[model samples]
Target: MNSASVISVVGPTGTGKSALALSLAEILDGEIVNADSMQFYRGMDIGTAKVSVAERRGIAHHLLDILDVTEEASVSDFQRQARQAIAEIQGRGKRAILVGGSGLYVRAVLDVLEFPGTDPRIRQRLEVEAEAHGMAELRARLQRVDPASAERVADDRRVIRALEVHEVTGKPFSSFMPVREYIQPTVQIGLDIPRPVLHERLSTRVNQMVDQGLADEVERLDQRGLRTGKTAGRALGYAQFLRVLDGEATVAAAAEETIIATRQFARRQSTWFRADPRIRWLDPREDDVVDQAAALCL
Candidate 1:
């Protein structure tokens, strides 16, 4: 009876993963720990869809909004904090429900991968190149070094991170990647809906964020001088909003750009989660996602 068994709610954005996690937390007397990268920052509410105090439904949540927008938070930071929270919850004889759409952060927590440590010189070089030739070019270079890792992480940021491993450690990125590690006593749940439905929901969700003052949130962060180099500042909506704030783009254009970027991010999440065998994929229309999760937990 390892109460430490994690109940992880994972899916692309706008799929009600948070809602499912909260409901299961309440039913199972569990505590929820955020796995989303964006949701970890303070003052990043609307666009991150951060669970508000009221919306927590009197359930305890961990690792949300503990960092300033100017801080540099990475997968290693997340993994350390998440593992601590999980241990604490299990010590309290409660369950830990890991919830979010950030597939990298989620996998880092569930698996045994050791993310490469950062090096100042390599990072400075990559930053210069990333801003010069673009993140795509760096990602392509990573593909030449390790195609398997590239497929598992088919994006600029992750590919850049894997590249960092190779450059810093003088080892192929895959050489550092951990072999498959089961999350002992853990059960994973992935949520999915029809593509049309999901996209429609995504559109409405973005519009709702606009109405809920996401622009103002970004503006506040901007006023604080939290530029795009910081983790929180680089969050999708904030980056687009930064364009509008810089007078580099129009409101309509920025909003459209945000939507387009988010859609592509969701596509990548689906690709990774679909390939993760640990997750028990479930339809969003399933009669009882929590019940199914609890069954798996037992």
Candidate 2:
């Protein structure tokens, strides 16, 4: 592997990205820089499927467990931290293996995308619009200004941010879309699975998380003010389990909802990653998947 090149392992959740990243790190003398937004929180272990220290096989991992649940995760922050980690890894004569399915986070690290500064007054106005007229209204307004970004911004928060960027920069948010250029040499290996197979896998994974005490995990975090967290509170499994804790749903019902939400999230991940032509696709189930990825890095 080229010492200056970073290896990125990305796919939908439950597609063995962690496993592949571990393998690549073992082979390439690499350390990991996480891009999974949820994994940034300290105690969000089971639901995010964070690889335990024992599971990492003594390989170094960076950018995990670096945030409190109450703090909002900023992509610009992640981009800076991740690039620093990668540079340090490479400076130490090791490879940097980037992992996770968060597409924008991944792009922030690898692409030449510039984040426009936010104007407090503009953001305040957008927030008011979102609150009074609903996300659909702001989304429709965004479509008029930046149709491409409007298509990608799914949630109220992102829609607000996109509009804030457009207002602050006097440019459409879509005009800031990442070009096929890298800040540094990088190789991205994407794991691909059939939709039915991925769905089944995701369902089974959610059940495994439940069995592993995801509900109890959420309850513990709740005591630490997880519900008050802007970002952490809305995580996939944690949010559903919070409903269970509130007596709004049964554990079984929460699990079902989590499964459904996870499937939808996976579809979005697929769409985000499939648009990147730089990623080399491979099947995680292939016996030599790690070798295939390593070949690309070389």
State the C-alpha lDDT per candidate: 0.82, 0.91
Q: What is the C-alpha RMSD of each candidate to the true structure, in Å?
A: 2.7, 1.5
TM-score, every prediction: 0.88, 0.95
- Candidate whose TM-score is highest: 2
- In model 1, pairs of residues that clash are none
Give the Cα-based TM-score of candidate 1 against the true structure. Answer: 0.88
Q: How does model 2 fare in lDDT?
A: 0.91
Residues 188-231 of candidate 2 have per-residue lDDT tens digits of: 99997999999999999999999999999999999998999989
* Alpha-carbon RMSD, candidate 2: 1.5
lDDT of 2 at 226: 95
Worst 10 residues of 2 by lDDT: 1-10
**lDDT of predicted model 1:** 0.82
* Model 2 backbone overlap count: 0
